[model samples]
Target chain A: MVEPVLDVKGLEKSFGALKATNGASLDLRPGEIHALIGPNGAGKSTLINQISGALAPDAGSIRFLGTDITMLDTARRARMGLARTFQISSLAQEFSALRNVMLAVQARQGTSLRFFRPVASDVSLTEPAMRMLSRVGLADRANVPAAALSHGERRQLEIAVALAMEPKAFLLDEPMAGMGPEGSKALTGFLDGLRREAPILLVEHDMDAVFALADRVSVLVYGRIIATGSVSEIRNDPEVRRAYLGEPA
Target chain B: MGARETTVNVLLVLLLPAVALTALFIGEAFYITLATRIAILALAAVGLNIALGLGGLVSFGHAAFFGLGGYVAGVLATHAFNMEPVAFGLPGTTAMPAIWLVAILLCGLVALPIGLVSLRTSGVYFIMITLAFAQMIYYFAISWPAYGGEDGLSLSMRNGFPGLNTAKPFPYFVVVFVLLLAGLLLFHRLRASRFGAALEAARQNPARLAAIGISPFAIRLVAFVLSAMITGLAGALFADLNRFVSPSMLSWHMSGELIVLIILGGKNRLFGPLAGAALYVLFEYALGGLTERWQLFLGLVLLAVVFFARGGLIGLLAGRPRHG
Candidate 1:
């Protein structure tokens, strides 16, 4: 069997009496869209946070490319090619869209430590950053500050930033949130093609986009993986139906 | 970038040196001394602006570094005067370059730990912790009897600068003015660099900074240490200007005034500290000459500026906050 690019095993976390994640195990193979689906407050985001190193699991082992990364910092994990985006918009609001993406490009190129040269005029940094921006269809709005961008545009900018990371895998949490249907359709198409670049562990609620894009689906209920299968099988599973899909068992 | 901002900057860069030179030509040593104060204070505020304006780290412990710089100058000047061999068997020298090197190194050494500890907490907690650490240093200065202690130490003469008679106010002002200009140019370069972009981004959203594969803690820490070194250098100049080193340099009021200098001119503007320092010194000279109770008038003026002018004097003039 091919080794998964991102592997998590027996992960667990608790806040007082509540278990945010309970022995959750999953693996993301290269170039596959593995969608994680759950009802609201089912700890999908919590699990993503733990996987992304934003929140540490109380007990678990996460191996990326076969190296254990459970104790690594979020930035270190990102540097190692594990990229992520927040569910809520987390961006440098005051920065223009081009500059925001340029930061990611600078980080990736290891040029952020160079203090003398102007990043604005550096063709090396701006060229790739602009390419990433264009990928998200934000080519024209590159100079607008992130705070001033419409909600859909901010979401697009986040994708541009992530793309600039040159990631080994992507952990996108609710990338479709706050996006109108047209924007959703556009991004859904983009993410579909993006999965070919790197495997994606997609945590999302929009079932239409999820079902359309996922190679396989895992139904998470109360932090446990209740079922994992191809999209249609998981969609028709009785456990997912009663516990999550709000259908009679 | 606006026409008004460019004109204001031209005036700011020109007026002080012009006035200082004119005063020197008129043979008024007192006015030259005042200009030196502005240059030194502006230099100190420029250092604080790196952390405060760009990185958005409001370091209240900056006075600690400033005072440390002053003390470095004082202790070395004292040891050199007494012909005492100091630690590491290196005899103290009254050389400006030597004193500046020692001051910057010592400030960096102290700032590393202070920044490491304080940067772990942010907002008001960070502010209080930095202030508390500075106060600790202040108390230590008062109690350390080997130096002048509570009364402070006085230099026998100004530290020597090679190829210049620094005892003369005009030449001394030239030294300070040149250093301050160099610092401003460096600040401009740093603000436009890649490091600066990440630092500013960290201030806006640390999580996003991390997501982009840069550690916010590391960025802010570097900025803090650099800020300390700059302020420490200014402190060295300030001690030389007055030919005195005291605990007051380490006081919270000193820290507050440094921040006020940044704010009064405009927070984060490259010329904000210079503008604020010029205005502050002007207020001190003008209002101080008029009445004994000038601080009250200064307070009222400051209140009007803070309440009505959110971006500060530069913001009032420049049509926008340049650095924010």
Candidate 2:
């Protein structure tokens, strides 16, 4: 088995009386495609948030690449090769699509305090961003403002930005949440290409895409993991079917 | 962003100096003085833009640092002219460069505390806290009897510039005009820097900025202080130009006017403050001459601009920004 790049044990979170996440645990091995699927309000986003250091879990220890990163801030976590995409697209809309990726590259490469020269002229930052954009099929739309991009294109741009970080693991929160059939197929192909390099923790509602791509599937219901196994095992499990699949086995 | 936008930017920067030179030549000493005031005030606005425009920190108490800069210049000149010692028995100097440095340092120091506290909160709370701090300083200035209290201090002669007669309106205007240009250039450079990008990112998407390894609070606080220092330098020039320093400079109204200048010109543009200041002074001169309640007209115009002109004069002139 591939050594785990991400390990979460006894992760718990609550909002007042509501337990949003309860003793949830997950393991994402290197170069593995892990799909976390559930209906609405399944705490999948919350789990990603904790691993990405956006939220502090109530009771849990998160280890990334053998380092205890539970106390790190989101940016620090990102710098440590952990990248994530927001459920709702959060990009610098006014800036060009290329500029967004360039900024991510700038964050990783050198001191961002370089003020004397124009950033666009800097080959170091722009080149890597361009390469990333091309990888995500957005090289042609590089100069267009992110606000002008289509929803699907914006999702592609978000992935491009994540790629600029050169991360070891990605917490992609519904990359195909609002995508159409064509968009979904494109994103799935993109994910398949990326799966040979870094591990992807995909939180998705699209079971078809999940079953198609996920090497290991984890079923979450009411903030608890009901089952975790291979696609066939999850599809055949009586408990998973009764609690989630809602189909007679 | 393109050759056309670049050409427009060049024309605007070049146009201000042309108008400033015309004002020096064709105008009376009074109008020349008015132009000087506009230029200096625009420089202050440019300073505020470093934070407000680029960093997205709307600091309401910038007047405190501005007034403090003016006081530093005024107080130092008063002591030097008299050949006496200041509060700590430190003899003052009449050198313009030294005064600017002192003003910048003092304002930066003062801004550190204000920024540290204000940065703890955000949105409405940040605005209110900064305003409250400025009021605190304004009240302090009004109550303090040492420098003339509310009466204000007047310089018998303008502070000396190294090789020129600063007492003459045109020469004095030239001095301030050059400083304003230099300040604008510095701002252009700062806005294009990596730190500037991070600061802007912090404003636009703080969560993402943090995810990228930059702390929003620290970035904003540093920007706030640097911004305050620049505005403070402009304020010192303002006092020297008028040969006067008063509590009015520190008033909350003055702070509001500075922000008004930024909005009027267009936030984040290179020459937005200059254009805004020129318009404001022109409006004040033209409207005040025509009506007794000129401020009422100005208020109405401002309202119209805020409602309709989303990007201000620069927006009207240059169009939407193409670059981040």
TM, chain A, every candidate: 0.99, 0.97
lDDT of 2 by residue, A1-249 (tens): 666999989899999998889999889998789999886788888888898898899998999999999998887788888888988888877788988898899888757767667787778888999999999889999999888999989999999999998889989999997999988988898898798879999998888889889999999887898899999999999988987888776
Which candidate number has the best DockQ?
Answer: 1
Supply candidate 1's per-residue lDDT for A201: 95
TM-score of the first chain in candidate 1 relative to the native first chain? 0.99
lDDT of 2 by residue, B158-182 (tens): 7888999888888888889889888
lDDT at position A74, candidate 1: 92
Segments in model 1 whose C-alpha atoms lie over 4 Å from true places: B322-324
TM-scores of chain B, in order:
0.97, 0.95
Give every collision pair in model 1: none
Candidate 1 lDDT by residue in tens digits, A164-205:
999999999999998999999999999999998999999989
- Model 2 pairs whose backbones collide: A75-B210, A75-B211
lDDT of 2: 0.86
